[model samples]
Target: MAGGNGLLEVRIAVPAKDASRIARLLVEERLAACAQVVPGMTSTFRWDGEVTTAEEQLILAKTHRSRFEEILDRVGEAHPYETPEIIAVPIVEASAAYAAWLVDEVAAGERP
Candidate 1:
C-alpha cells in the first residue's frame, strides 16, 4: 500500500540486455541496497494505438522510500522506452534482521 517500514521494492522493466547494467547502476550508486534481475518475462501492452508483446527483464530493487524519485530519474535516463515501467511498492513486512541490513546498505552518506 502506502507506507510501511520505510522500505520499498522498486520494479523496472527493461530490455533483457539492459537488465544487468541497470541493476548494477542502482546498487553501485547506493540508491538501492540490492537489485535482482529476473529474465524471460513476457509482457503485452498497448503502445501507440497498437498492442505489442515482447520479452523483457525485470529489475527488482530494494531501497528506502526516500530514494524513489532519484531511482525514477536515473532509470528514465538509461531506459530505452519512452515511458519505462518504474514503480515502487512498500515493504509492509520484513524480517527485522533483513530490514536492518537493507537500511544499512543504502544509508545516505555511507558506503557498504
Candidate 2:
C-alpha cells in the first residue's frame, strides 16, 4: 500500500565511518527529508557459500518513492560495498504534516 505522497522509508547499511557521509549527502541533496544513522549493529549473511559477519551502521532515509532511483544512485556513488544494501519500503500511512514535509523536501532542491 502507498500513501498519497507515495513516500518511502529507505534503509541502507554502511561502515560506521561512512554512515555520516551517506546521511549528510542525501539530506544535503534534498533527496530525503530526514536521515537517521544508528550504530553498533552486526549483520550476518552468506556470501559465495561462506557465512560472514559485519559491523555496520544503519542509515534510514525518508523520501518520496519517486526519488528512490536517485537515492540509490547517490548512495552507490559513495558506498564502498560492491553491493550496498539499499531497500525502500512504502509508507502506507503518515500524518498529514509529515507527508507534506516529505513531499516538499524531495520535489526539488532548495535555491540559494
Clashes of each: 0, 0
lDDT of 2 by residue, 50-70 (tens): 999999999999998778888
Per-residue lDDT, model 1, residue 42, is 96
Candidate 1 wrongly placed segments (more than 4 Å): 1-3, 109-112
Model 1 has a clash total of 0
- Candidate lDDT scores, in order, read 0.90, 0.89
Residue ranges of candidate 2 with Cα displaced over 4 Å = 1-4, 110-112
| Candidate 2 CA-lDDT value | 0.89
Q: After superposition, how far is residue 82 of candidate 1 from its true place, in Å?
A: 0.7
